[model samples]
Target: MTHSASPFVPDPSRYIKRSSREVPVGPVTIGGGSPVVLQSMLTSDTLNTEACVREALDLVEAGCELVRITAPTVKDAANLRAIREELRRRSCPVPLVADIHFKPEAAMEAAQWVDKVRINPGNYADRKKFVVRSYTDAEYASAVEQLEDSFLPLVELCLRRGIALRIGTNHGSLSDRILNRYGDTPLGMVESALEYARICRKAGFHRIVFSMKASNPRIMISAYRRLVATLQELGPDWNYPVHLGVTEAGDGEDGRVKSAVGIGALLADGIGDTIRVSLTEDSVREIPVAKALRSLVEQFATAPRPRDRIVPPFDPFSFQRRESHRWDRNPTVGGGEPVRVAVLEENLAALEAASAGTEIVPELGYQPRLVEEVDPEDSAALTALGGGPPRLVTIRDGCPYPPLYAFRMLAARIPAHHPILLKDTFFPGEEGDPLRSLLNSALQLGALLCDGIGDAILLRGEADPRKALELSYNILQATGNRSFKADFVACPSCGRTLFHLQETTARIRKATGHLKGVKIAVMGCIVNGPGEMADADFGYVGGAPGKVNLYVGKKAVRFNIPQEQAVDSLISLIAGEGKWVEPPSS
Candidate 1:
């Protein structure tokens, strides 16, 4: 049943936490087999000491282990002293981290006050004008030398101050140097951080954490796996703790589903040390979602084992949907078809009632009488169906293997023509608790979807039929398997945001939520804007206070539109591009 294993993951079959070297952040310890740490960032302006202090206190009260404040300028960075002093005066001892971008001066100023400094390797030294040009070997080496000149001092400062450094890289913001070489890929994201890691190692600095973030879960997951695999290849000392997140994960259920899929999938593979569920809302609201996600992953511990050695059927670092011929044409499944959604027979009416005006509705309902169920561990049972005519088959619940491994086993043994139906639960447990139910379904089903295993998904456990239907489509959207509504990639607000992100996001969503298949990105500032919104069809970004910048793909097409007209302008941009359709009127 098995041959070789991927160096990226030791065993993709179960939840065995990956071992990492412990790095200290003030009073908290990350990695070294420690329980996963929870962290969140402040949305208040750094210049406003009282607001920053208040938000920090709220996050700390909500059980956040680490609090990050953005420092977009030297003034903002210097203001961290006042915020830190106030927190200390209040007797709050939570570790503080300064989020820095494109400013070594700010990072240097921040080091004096905070417990940790997070630097984006993509923009820390390199300017991202989105320039593309090939470099000769000598030219590339010179760029590296200059980068070290600017970055090595920070490494020395962190070492001297006895503080930790996180060389975080965002998939949307990789440097032009990396993009020219590796393209905008997970490999590029990994190498961007590795360059800084090499600098830290050369300078004998060991207190470090690493993160690979993206708005897309597939890219985020792949970057982290490639990074860890690269570290493993670098030898024993490169096991720095990892911080998992999916950046700009919109708000509400969409935000939760995306965060759960991205963070929960990696946790399922045993790969996170710390996590932040980035949402476009109040910072404190993110903590419980993070905790719920951790709790949901804990359930993976109860997963049953496979009868034999399980061989991975898909690449862990890249997404290439598994091939299976479509058995039905109208509501397609497999062989390059959009992943379909299904509901239980009894809940079909509720699903329809719940999805009255929504474009994303269930394509099928599970009729147990028509579909044959097979236990994954029963090899003879799977073999028996191989010679039969193509039909819709579903895996049995309460199997020896969890759905993640169960589906893998089934896919490995069965013929490609038979379409597989995926269910949220592989075993029955408690019935209530919608939050845990959403997290569990996202983790289990999303993990399989990311691995390119599921053809159609049936969400059980969630008692609200409408909520379950929404979760099903949201899971598919988050996994990049399908999109039935306007796709949004929004950043959680920080000190750098120029406008009210929460209100702006809500307004923009109201205007464009009806536009099916349009990918829109709403960013707070330039730091995570242009590049982060690379995959979006239209972008609404903060250019300055009371102003917005609009983009078509990665190129900025409109600038300095008053924030009052931004949503309308975005609609016009979409309309002008022929993506706009009249919203249904009551």
Candidate 2:
């Protein structure tokens, strides 16, 4: 069968624009329009060349696009070289990256054989000169010069050998100058790595990758997002391949969750070029997790495209088909009609008043009177109120006691015989210590509550009450639940804040009240807005009192929209795009 030119067209402009350099890591192309790659490092002793090679091969076999091995000493560097030769001789085609520290000779040796070299700028200080001379301005300059010279040889070797370089900066080992200037922040990490990248570029080596590793996943996520945004602001033409990871990600389940949240968020935003799951266990075990993460990203994420591209037309037929399937399966929406709404509340007068202007049919029931209160007879009434099992439940604030206790009680009271839906609640408390402790406790309690009980969990933060709600909705959807309400998550601005955050957030919430399952975050400043609010479906960040930056799902959609109209504009955009639907009627 001969193929003909069809209606489908692959637009060049739709491709994410990247630097046109050959990424030297295996089949993975980093600084180009290739798929984002997944990589991991081997924890095996580098001095044992055969063991390192075996781990590398295992990682490659497990779908790792690249692998890194540590060369801690000259002997380890020699072993690394031997491993490279063995791979070449055995026709094992995976690319190897050599991670080096203070030993510049080892770095130089590895650069000659490996595809890439990772150097920590902090650890690369010239200790030889520091030991030899007393502290002085002259001595400091000489030390810096000596350090530069040491790296220069490796840089030269890499340049000649066509090896890519990665200036990997870590939070724990930040250079004194960077830490002093920018504090131990994401911006500081970016500055330090960029400074090193500039030095490498000036030395006639341009193939570079960068990573800012932090033990805190949230910080890591924020740092990378800021770095990417900053780079874009500097110039669209300025692009660098990035290596992503959550440093010291611990071991086992906790590490996996942390790594997933950090790496997954970046991948969702089209920011990560490569990933490493930096677990405390044998790093080779991280390879499979890295591959799994990449697969998850490819499966669930929206593909990245250049800003210039006209977005492809959405397939309305597919959407309609999905809705049709849902409607058919839902017994409440018989005859292909929308489901009826039912209100379930204990305060009959308040419920009546709240439902007065709405089309909902009122169903009066006794709400649980206390934490341990339960009535088996209420199950049928609750089901009827929701027209089946509720897909979502909202727990009010001002609980009589600790919120976690209330949640547990509610979870226990809900009937176990039916498909009882999950619930999200708003808990009011002060910020910082109390809220953090509350959230941590809630998570632990939630784990118990969710044991074969609920489908999703949401912890409401007092910083922005609406944001807590929105986060609940997103978390539900992310966990495969099909129902929720819109929530807005806004932050309290400080002295460095750029806009009238409080007023703007209130106005946005009021303006977007009609939409359900939508999430909007109005952040006080641009620095933390993008990263801290990564989970938001829609975000309005303060640029100035009258201006704000708008984002949808990690991608900046517009900038400097009028603060008064930003919320309305976002609502209009969501409606026009038809990306979401009304909550199903009970």
Candidate 3:
């Protein structure tokens, strides 16, 4: 039956055009243009065939199109065969995928019993411990060649029997040769697996799936992006089903969040063909999360809709109406002027010293004020006075109230037009859940509290504070507010720094501290300093102890200042260039 000509359309058929080389795994057609299937493995022991079968049935109900069972030994393979038979007899619908490691004999055995076989190339080449204490390079190669010969028989068996193959690459198990060639990157994983795919294809096998699993979400996302781009470049006909997964995603909340971010990003981008959320705990629960992710992607289909005039739902971040009058009005004071900013110091002496040469206006636009101190009458009067409402309000620590709950209450009481900023407070005993819950709640409230928000987000161990600040600034800047300061991109110096970069940066910051809208970068090494600091308005880079390269944008303006005087020299340069000025006192 022609898919488009049919009156009844299958939901999966709506996304993927049916393919000639399709592999049907239960209700899901893998190779044919079908919505990529989400699959997971049963963590239950295969030795207990009843438990394994029961788990498979549960996963099927949970929307797992395919389920994998581990067969580590000959005994395990026997149990897996029995489970498959039991499920088949009971008329269970989900296809079973057998996962085998190291032992090609076990894989060969499981191939006859399961619908698909998942093999790790690294495991195929593994030498048994009892073989030999002194095998020559040629002898080792001969052993591998023999193993490859044995493995091909299993591959051929699967192909001849119409069983699918998945060349699964785990981050931990990548061969040292591939690592040496491609530096343990996603490219290496793809290249390694493609080589295996070539072997399968050469043996007259076209039914295949590929997966590269990583615990790090960023690395996983990057690898998948690169792989998809590479496949597209290879040509349209080269398309094959790609399985997405964040492997070793720790059990519970951490795993859920990590899997969601990694899987969600790829699904949103229209790349993944299948997904697996590999949590360390019971595999049964993971099926729901994986199915939910696929459902989320279906809602974001990039395929052009049938009607031209149909208006879809607006994505909160991307949608902005030109007719909204708020965009035209100058919503900030100082005629929408940018505010000068400085990191606060506890010492009043240093604070006074930093503010010495800068003009401190009584009210410069929407300064962040303590929420507890702001009177209700004053808040009302400010609205009555009306030259744009205050932008930020810091919730003081130890204020005898939950900041988020209090903010919600305050938001209800405040004038509709006024927006308040809720600052993230650092507490000794606070955990991530409360902070995440509060932040998510605040985001949901929209523009009622502020145009946008900022957090003094702290990082753990060794990360550059400047990089953290830049990331935070980018997030806030994306909100379309112009009153923010230029980001300070500085690196935390290590023993490698030729100059005392940290102290020098502090001094330069002290000198031009009053300049709010200017971005200054302080970097340790010249190698990545210029490139990394390309986004900054100005940069100071260390060359040697007592020497600095001053940059305005990307160009180097001056170099070779005395070690002790480098900070002053950069400051003088800023002042001479009219980038620094005195501030009015309170």
Candidate 4:
């Protein structure tokens, strides 16, 4: 595999955040050495002035630095004026962002009322009909001209109004032009945003931020890294603030795990200027999670690291599993096998107690005496170990570098296929807040896993062995490394949602939680529903108020079923597709 000499993060030795241009959204500033800002979107309809105002206040009170409201049409965009007026009358001055998709007029109108306006590059000036066609040089240049015509007005307007613009791109919503050229990859996501960014820069408008969002954590992580690298390649002044998130991350533990893995990884890498944890619950509920993750990054930033800089061993832009030979036959540890989940237990009795009666047992129980542990800084020792027969190797506790860097250093020194076991912490007995540990583990381990570094993971900081075992599997699932249960891609509710998303998501999960390895998507609207859920096995989407649409892999077979009967119909659809199985009795 080809490797980049420059590290993905700016400074591997310390938490030196990427140097970026500060963009002001109202009074709050992002990037330019600013502490990462926290933000969330309102679920209340834009037309409901009172509800929108109340939700905005609630989010601000819950520590949301910026609030976003959806404006799907010109009328909805106009309503943002009322929401803004109401918020100001109540003395809540949190800067508001208007989310616009497929509507340039709405973006223009929203810009008049809000502090910032967000436009999805995939749909801002382009249509998404999933059409497949080739664009010649002439056709492509014409498309770019059309995009400039549609987007330049907004750039000019935002410049005059002193409003910031977020050129956000989603994985599933790439325009046919981008898809045909870039093929729905992370590179496509970054290129989509940069196309609009080029227009803003040409207009001499610098109040801009960017987000590369996806439901899958691995894709989200890679897209952000690629965006940063691409921006670096463009020029020194091209460093714009970045907003990080994993969109359509479902509710509860699953949602938190996914968000932490994606957002936390980037934060640890010192790439994000602002962050939002997109949970499919009340918008206010998202703040605490974001706060926890931010706190973890802050603490890591303050902590000391070795003076020497070490380069990353693998490519950060793409997911290429490191070549490794088969190290074990039973519950395989390497050789193109699924990443194994393991636990750090002293003996068999403790392992039994922790994983007893659990189907998701650790494949390997690591005891210090049985496995070889090498000093992370000692490359000579690691090379000597690599010269011998392949055996399980890991960083010994108390490495000078941080856990994340220590592992990267080890990966660099060892053979490509050494089957290294990853741990959340390299230091023993360093424990405090459970939430901190959870987020830290996700950030460090998730960062490595997404980089295709880890073959096995151990949650060493978690004291509760059962919880540790469960979290290890959750991290694996969130990183898209493995799936022990059904997978979900549910979007956080916004003003465009037609029905209660939290309740519907719970109902669907209850019915299908038993289907192992099944990938399902629960979306609130078609704004991003059909495209975002393209990789899902089945889709449960809101068609309208109390209405639902079901799809079997990008094709909607059932439309406008009443919300109450939608779950049953979905089950039947799954069975019809030969994917449904009866749940095992408790």
Candidate 5:
């Protein structure tokens, strides 16, 4: 049955509906069967009204339906009124969302000025110091009661001001109390937001959306899935809209691919209502990526629910690489190996033409043909004419349809077990920016890779062959499917960062750029360092003024080392662990 976008109506449908309550952020409706909306954030300083307005307008013009600005203090939040007024004067009326992390007063003040306010549950009332403490049941109850007492005013203010609220939880920013109980896991992330959500619900504050963001796609996807599953247990009334994002995803191809993997995986499960492709780049650059993802969801998401499809046996809540017992023809195609990249060769002439200019690596294969329309006799024809089995089955794009949707629909009709190549074709927009094409390619193909689908990626269009090859590898590495070079996890710094994160990250990258297959994280402070770098092999974190804390995984192996000597110490730690290799000649 269909659901209405009204607070009084209950959404009972699964999959597309996600059984979530409807919330209105300005004129845009989220959850309760509403179409997924697109959003992005302004990176400029909030106090800089001129810069913030320009960036926000750019984001809006680029198709961002909702724009968020950070308000770290009372005054910073007050300036939100100026930003909103200026946008109105300039003829852009996009809804504004104020991002609040540590200040409750700012949340209260921000609510009066913007259309929406987003509060981080981890730091709204408490700062984390990794302290360990034990609490009696009475004491725990008392602490929660105090928090509710404090949070009730803000909830009441939102109700009076007609503003929406988002209880956003970041994977790396969970407080010590949460860690003490849940151990920095996805369950902990969900509980952090639920604590605030339960408070809002108790106070009749239902104009809410929730987000579980993380830098690691695997962790982010798992946390959101766990959030939905937990909410499902609480019954139909608890399903609020979820805002999907991969926070602090780094620049260019890396950023786009990482965001796609997390956001797309969730959207594929029909779990998200609004999406923000959180790239550490220009705010306007994020809009196209967000729209592309929205388009993908609209194109492929079926009404009867993809649940009916004969999907491969795999768990969505946990990270499990897709597996197969045997390949029918291509014996080396499946059975749990790192995915291989292949080039699509349609006809013999096209293959000959491409081979003349393309670098033919010894390992790369050129598939002969791709079947689009399935005929009743096609299986019989294949069996009768087959000799040694098709090396790889390819799904190509000859029409305007999305390659991914085509891939899925065609693959479902074929065998239950066979490695398929997802051949995504791309053409630059009217602007002729090759970067846009690259972003779209990653948005479409990266989604499949993140879900453990697609055996190979074949890029087609007018871009340079060398660039295509590099981008293919980058997409694979970004999605955690494969890696061939140094992977760096650097935080997007805020007011809390103690050092120059950009320059220091560059310095660390220069010294360790040669260590292939090694993952390094450079964090500005302890706030997001330890938890955000959950997957990094080693971490370089700012501990205090001019001092650094180096970590092997999440454990601080060396504490309080001088800033000048920190890089050397990190190297030593890596070398000590036998994971570092000497750099070749400069």
Candidate 6:
């Protein structure tokens, strides 16, 4: 891949953050060379004014730059006015964003209250029953005209009211029209957002930021890269800011891993201006996660290198591990093996107990003093082992490449064959904060693995070594690096769920947890079933009430199986495919 140069940045910086028009949302400013902003959503029901106000205040207190509340209806959009007023009264004047999914009227109404309005171009004016039809060129143009007519009034009103718009596109929610023509691909996601962006531009409205969100990090990264490249091709005058996120990213370590993989990969390329970490936990808790991820981005704000070194070893626009001479250093790591796990905890005994065969780099002098390069003698001494020559599993570095720019500079100087253990120190926010430890480790390490950069992941934390090891593998598995056990790609149940998602997911996971390397998806509804499961090996999606549809890859193998029998049927399907081995009886 070659780096394309442009005039907007003059010299070395053009290769960094893609230039975007400075979009203002009340007191906060993003894009146009502004610092990367952090955002989160309010989970309280929009009708519950007290809860909504309370949640907004809590998020702002936690360093949330922009707060979005779901406005699924006109009334919910109306409640935002009181929520905004109350938050301001409480001295929390963070910019409010209205998340409008389907209703154009709600978006118009929300613009009257919130500083910014985020509309999903996928579901704004189109439907998603998963049907396909051919569209003639004339018919498509007419559809565009109708869509523009529907959106122009809001654009006009937003311009008059000084409100910003985010034309966000979701992978699972693409309209049938876009899907029919482009299929469910990254190009489709980009086109879906650009369709609205084109109309907004025609109406002389420029206060727009765009996002392409998917549960899968690879697709999310590719789409954002393609979107930026497409905009550059369109012209520098079409500069628009980008908001980065990965939607429906589950919960706990898995969610954090998925979100980090998608969002971090883009930020490393200097592509994102504002970021939101979508977790299944409390919205206020999301702020810390966003800050942790953004730290890496800020650390590498400038272009890492003059154009040539801009792209990493592998192509940034696609997924391909860099070419390297294999090193069979550790049994599970290096030599083209699946990415390995390592730990640097204080308790040597606990570390040994947790990872029987895993490598443990000493904590002393691990944090780099120079931040760039270390003396060669010191590096060699650190990696020197008593056992016949140091293996590739262990690496000695001056400092951690928390930012991609640092990584690029160091990778250029280091040996390609030597396996490197990327490190991130996990920080649990406060005492008694559940999920904090897991989320911190996942986002920090999973970010690099998603880009196919690391040979092994190292999480330095104070938890039990076994827990840290488990968290390391979970991060790797979530980022498609390694799988130690069955991977459950379940969605956080929404209102349309047919069965008890939490209990059913637990049951399915327990029953099949022994099947190593198998990816099983348990989705709550047809709305988020197949598309959301993207690369899952098998799927158990909600069909009719109490019935589940089973899938192999994207094809449904069984239909309408009773909820009580679904888990067994899934097991049989796996056995029939030679993927199931009976769990040893305790």
The global C-alpha lDDT for each of the candidates, from Candidate 1 onward, is 0.86, 0.54, 0.53, 0.86, 0.71, 0.71
lDDT of 4 by residue, 139-212 (tens): 99999999999999999999999889999999989999999999989999999999999999999998989999
Q: Candidate 2: which pairs clash?
A: 466-488, 467-488, 467-489, 470-487, 485-517, 486-517
Distance from true location, Cα of 313 in model 2, Å: 27
lDDT of 1 at 424: 81
Question: What are the per-residue Cα lDDT tens digits for candidate 2 across 64-148?
Answer: 7787777766777777778888878888878888877667777877777778888887666522111222346665456556667
Report the lDDT of model 2 for residue 51.
73
| Better candidate number, 5 or 6, judged by TM-score | 5
Off by over 4 Å in 5: 1-21, 31-35, 85-92, 131-143, 301-308, 326-331, 344-362, 369-420, 425-440, 454-463, 493-510, 524-527, 540-579
lDDT of 3 by residue, 125-218 (tens): 5522212245566764565466567668887998778888888875535555555445456677777677677667778887887777665455
Residue 478, candidate 4: how far off, in angstroms?
Answer: 1.1
TM-score per prediction, in order, is: 0.96, 0.50, 0.50, 0.96, 0.78, 0.76
Pairing residues by index, what is the TM-score of model 1? Answer: 0.96
- Model 4, stretches more than 4 Å misplaced? 11-14, 329-331, 346-358, 428-431
Cα shift from native, residue 96, model 6 (Å)? 2.4
Count of clashing pairs, candidate 6: 2
Q: What is the lDDT of residue 392 in candidate 1?
A: 72
Q: 142-248 in candidate 1: lDDT tens per residue?
A: 99999999999889999999999998999878899999999999999999998999999999999989999999888888889898889989998898999999999
- Candidate 6's TM-score reads 0.76
How would you encode candidate 6's per-residue C-alpha lDDT over 423-501 as one tens digit per residue?
A: 6542222343334445445645665566566666666542555666666776777777766678777765433457877
Question: What's model 1's lDDT at 162?
Answer: 98
Whichever of 4 and 6 has more lDDT, that candidate is 4
Task: Give residue 3's lDDT in candidate 2 (0 to 100).
Answer: 17
